[model samples]
Target: MTASPNRGLALTVGAILAIWGILGFFFAGEGGHAFFGNEGGYLWGVFLVNPALCLVWTLLAAAMLIGGLGTTIGSRNLNLLAGVVLLVLALYGLLFMNTSANVFALNAVDNGFNAIVGFVLLLTALAADRENLRALRADRDDLDALRAEAAHG
Candidate 1:
């Protein structure tokens, strides 16, 4: 299949997230914070991170990479799923950032990043895959028509 926007975004974002997650581990608990607490140190003095958050990002990166390496529909669907999940996480982080409930050690920057990336993923998946879907359906219909014609002939 042709390279779609969703596929490209998924691969690119997944790679970046994977790298960040991996590197974040080296700095996790730098100040002796809890594994899941919000008091973890900053990554590159920007993004707040912890072991749990790194694990989450690694898992998310896996999903994104799997989707990106699969079919177009798979990429789009995974992007949508990831988008929704990230948006929810963003909201949760915003609400519990400074509380004990901040299990992912999220901060304002993380929440904002999640929200923006989530929105972009959602928008790209929803609005950019129409042509691909239509083309796929057309191909399937053509294949079916050809099979029927062969059987009848």
Candidate 2:
């Protein structure tokens, strides 16, 4: 009930890495499991694909996602950790999944998602790289006082 955005995003990243890792754990017999009709299998039951690394990635993402949510809901720094993880994973996805033609179109879609997530995380990390938060050279109160003084004083 009312989960934070970081928590939601963490779940998403966790799910992606976890599912992919678990799926990798399952050995596919070439020809794409015969059920879907492709010719791709997870291969080596995920051992060769660096299952451990995927797990690490998931754990990092979990922290960062939660942290990011903390930042969003609490303070700006709450999600810095999560943002880092997102950036790393985005790069990882781009490096590992982007060029792969093994999984048909799935890899492409995943890579696209990875790019989006990474970019968003980068923005969050950079605080949108905002030039300023103030509306003008002076504060609102100052502007209001000026206006009031000009009008009555």
Candidate 3:
């Protein structure tokens, strides 16, 4: 029942992504070029800070945050899946930087950032799962030891 260390990592990452996505819209401006570059196009400088990309990031953030809150196997599985999907999307963006084939305003900088973020999420999820398993095994061992002591005494 203890929370995984990676749960904090997930929450942090999710909050950051969610905040960035939300702030992106405000800074986008009417011309869609307030913070770094313009929007409404497939590519913009080295960032794909479009509304669609923002929305996607926000949703992903939400999923990660929510998944991190639960201590169930299902929640962990969902987190793993989300991490994989994020990594795939980042890889796709990197592979097709010049094209808008995936409907994402991808660029080397943004995609590279995405890749790092995704990698972190994936690594954290794996670590969390491993920790959870270790905890379970320890619990079982403790129970076994207790039962043995009870039987002997």
Candidate 4:
């Protein structure tokens, strides 16, 4: 049988989250040694940039995206939070990173792409909740109509 629209929507969001998370794991591991230029808490690679922060943001985004799974039950907050974290991570890469002679240009590319996707995830999460909200409104309207009828009777 065909899946309901809401379930389809949730599955799509979940898939995106999972894919992004997997990509992030690879990005974080390689980033510390390739970009930041260092090996520990600090970066020793390109322009002494810190890839550690990227790891943190990526994890946070992962968490947020995972939270989107619960959006069906009015848990869009996680998705929203993920969007914010991704945006913030993008900004960090944009503002602090020295793109002049970066090793992996793909890192920069992923950062930019993730920024756009973060917002999209948030939008999709909201859209998925729309049907549930409509149902609630309908229920409220029916209750009001019943009350009115009772008053007349």
- Indicate which candidate wins on TM-score: 1
Please give, for residues 76-125, the per-residue lDDT of candidate 3 as tens digits. Answer: 56556766877887887777656546455556776777788778767766
Candidate topping lDDT: 1
Model 3, runs deviating above 4 Å: 1-3, 32-46, 72-75, 137-153
lDDT of 2 by residue, 26-133 (tens): 543334343222233543332223333344545655555455444333322433454555556556655556344322222444445545665665455455323332
Model 2 ranges off by over 4 Å: 27-49, 61-79, 89-111, 124-153
Q: Report model 4's TM-score to 2 decimal places.
A: 0.50
lDDT of 1 by residue, 4-120 (tens): 999998998799789878888888869787887877878989899999888878888999998998888899999999899889989999999989899889999989988998899
lDDT of 4 by residue, 13-56 (tens): 55654554444445446534544332322222321223444455
RMSD each, Å: 2.0, 10.9, 6.1, 7.1
Error of 3 at 64 (Å): 1.8
Error of 4 at 24 (Å): 5.3
Which 10-residue span in candidate 3 carries the lowest summed lDDT?
34-43
Q: Please list the C-alpha lDDT of all candidates, in the order they appear.
A: 0.89, 0.46, 0.66, 0.51
In order of appearance, the predictions have TM-scores of 0.90, 0.39, 0.69, 0.50
Candidate 3 lDDT (Cα, 0 to 1): 0.66
